[model samples]
Target: MSAVPEPAAVKTAVITGADSGIGRAAAVRLAEAGMDVGITWHTDEAGAERTAREVRERGRLAAVARMDLTRLPEAADTVDALADELGDRVDVLVNNAGTGSAVPFLDLGLDDVRRVLDVNLVGPFLCAQRAARRMIARGEGGRIVNVTSVHEHQPRVGAAPYCAAKGGLGLLTQAMALELAEHGITVNAVAPGEIATPMTGQEDTDVRTVSRPGVPLGRPGDAREAAAVIAFLAGPDASYVTGASWSVDGGMMLMGPMAGSHLTGDDWRRP
Candidate 1:
């Protein structure tokens, strides 16, 4: 019997915050899977370049752009610029550029809250809107994978704004999915737990082992593993799956109330 030929790759994806952490990993992994990736960085031009180099080395085209999501005025323009760089077409868009804050609710400044919302929610919404327009214009469907966090469902004591932004993003994903379904566009989210990356920078100790004992997976997730999940959702395989938030969180969310109660130290007093 004769062998069948492999299918050719068809798409280009734009990944924000591609300079580091999950963004960088997604860029590299998607490119390795034979998809061209458009990389965007907020400040780390060098880091973005490094990721772009890896993509090209893997035999995929990569286009790098500078984008500061916190600046809402530039969010749509940033997406348009990236699409232009990719020859006026984009097949997938991953909204991953976000910041973390350990600021307590009482201590959080208004500016900080706005910054988080602008970057995590507004930025992604604007970018997705722009990308969807291009996809519609080209008369082809597209995919949008929002890089949310485990905090989207679970609460973190010192991370009020972060949690709020991610939760909003989860809802936004659902909303986008419903509205875009007619156009064959899918919207989904990848909510990762504690992943080993520059953002978590806990090299000396594994927080997941000591802090998250209730989780089915004892250790923290690697950025690449999280990236693989995002890549799957971005690919054609996830066409039927939309408006869903996939938890790549070592089963943390599944641990229920007991797991959350264990993380609370407020009841413990030093008398």
Candidate 2:
């Protein structure tokens, strides 16, 4: 692709794992903001199609591809392919694909840990590199948002591998932000807390009715809540923001000290 002047407004975005949950939300949200989007899914092509349909409904172009993060370097190529479909423009990239394990630390096997790392850390790492290179080649600034979990900052008892991967990705976001700032690129992490999504086994449930006493908001967050943050980071409004971790946790992260002292049983030890 040849270099071209940057558009005044972001035109295209590529989001990984857009088959469902936060990924799907972000895709539609970006489309609503007048951006064409390329979506990637792991094993749910039907769900991806649904997400694409929503994007197109907003009159924005949408493309879909199967991306298996476990495939490593090869899987990341999906990023370039999607950019090609978007007319060779990649203004924003959302590294939202990830996997998790609920097994205790001692019970975690080597292979399980590797799998988590591959999906959560390594895959996003490579995908961002591809998007960043394309952005640089076009001589246009870009945006990159990594969807980390609240665990990225705090630890949980049964999520050893998940925590490790998210924590690593969190730091990686900062490093990339610093290095890419010169290129007019901004990198940030959107760390989400308990959200009512398929990944949390609460798909389609009304979060307002589900009380979460531990969270100051007293309820789980909606996927759209997190997507709003991602959209802000990708849009022109957040041009000056970089290397920041925006928590969409509904104040869950603020309960660390309160939860630590109020725990009355060992139930928290199990996943």
Candidate 3:
């Protein structure tokens, strides 16, 4: 009989855009799962500090850095900075930093499209490269979870850049999974829909009291709900899962056709 190999221990993680929302929740969840954390914020330093406090309260070490993904290849250095501060090896990385635009597809300026693509797609690509290099050098397996969105699979009227970037990222996840498998690195994506978070302008609001008519669950998802899936992918339990896009959308994806069939006017066209 062959003996089973022990699952690799995840000692440290680097999470970007963790100053609020799903990123914040994922950082805390990972901390609770017994991993030191490196948190990155774009503009909300105070919010990142609060997230760090939560991680520390969980008795895990926490480090913070400012990561502006729009800065491109240079901003990705934040990943290495965080990894270095947290003991030189990143056992997990959550590329949660992103931006979106709501302009109509024809109205999007080149700069607007570029900014969205750079922040949402290019940034995660570079960060993953940096972390994967470290993981390879360390000779230990690693996990990477990219926080995409329902836009990855379906399009909204005013989200040209967002949909483009997320769709690209979803495909990137599959490519990374195939190539990284040889290095014992697993890559996956978590796509959330209508989650109550700062990104969706729902900060500090109780999700249970809000309603999402398009979602079959009848409510927007909690950031913690998405974070739970992220934490699972980062931990040993999901060791065998990779290249999969887990939708934490409360069945929103299933209602797309239903929603289209029920629209009554052109109001849906004006983001």
Candidate 4:
């Protein structure tokens, strides 16, 4: 058998919220994997520029754009601008920008709930639509990966809006996959557990507890680890994989309410 050569084509990917956390990791990894990257940051230009620098070090073209996802009117235009700047329509789209609310569900104002939904759900819908249309016009297969979270399936006490939005995103991924498959486009999602990142907080007690005896892996997931999954789904290897919600949660989802109930039992070690 002959070894396959590295891909020579110069692919382009547009990643939202590329300034930090999983988004930052993904941008760098994709650039290293030989893809020109278009990145968007909501506020931190410095961080975005740093990510671009890293991409350049990987010897790939990098374009940075500022996007406030709340301004839903600008979503498609934002994608078009990146496609123009990158000199190719997006071959991959990673919808990783998301915000969460810690307030109790009852105390949450309508505006706050709406804000979360707009960024997490509506923003990705607009961006994916724009990117898919361009890719379909080109008559080439493309990939769209939504960065969901474990909360997409499991409910959290104070994260009603975040959970709801991600849950909606899961279904949206399926719907988009069905609709876009005919156009040679694939839509999928990566649902990560408590990953160590700025978004998760370096000192977050939640992440620490997440890796306790409760979790099967007994540790919180790393941002780079999550990025690896996104990279695979974005690359050619995932051609047959679409409309799938791949959970990167260290088996957290498998731990039901009875996971720890047997911890006190002497027979708990039998497994």
Tens digits of per-residue lDDT, candidate 3, 59-100, equal 999999998888878998998998888888799999999899
Candidate 2 residues 100-211, lDDT tens each? 9889898999999999999999999999999999988877789999999988999888788999999999999999999888788899999998888888898888998886
- lDDT (CA) for every model shown? 0.83, 0.90, 0.89, 0.84
lDDT (Cα, tens digit) per residue for candidate 4, span 1-271: 2222232243999999999888989999999999999999998899999999999999999999999989986865778898889986788999999999899988999999999999999999999999988887777768899999887787877789999999999999999998887777789999987677777684223454543465576767777888999999998888788899999877778874235212333343357
In lDDT terms, which candidate is top? 2
Clashing pairs in 1: none
After superposing all C-alphas onto the true structure, candidate 1 shows an RMSD in angstroms of 6.2
Residue pairs whose backbone atoms clash in candidate 3: none
TM-score per prediction, in order, is 0.88, 0.93, 0.93, 0.88
Candidate 1 TM-score versus the reference: 0.88
* Angstrom error at residue 58, model 1: 0.7
TM-score of 3: 0.93
Candidates 3 and 4, the one with greater TM-score = 3
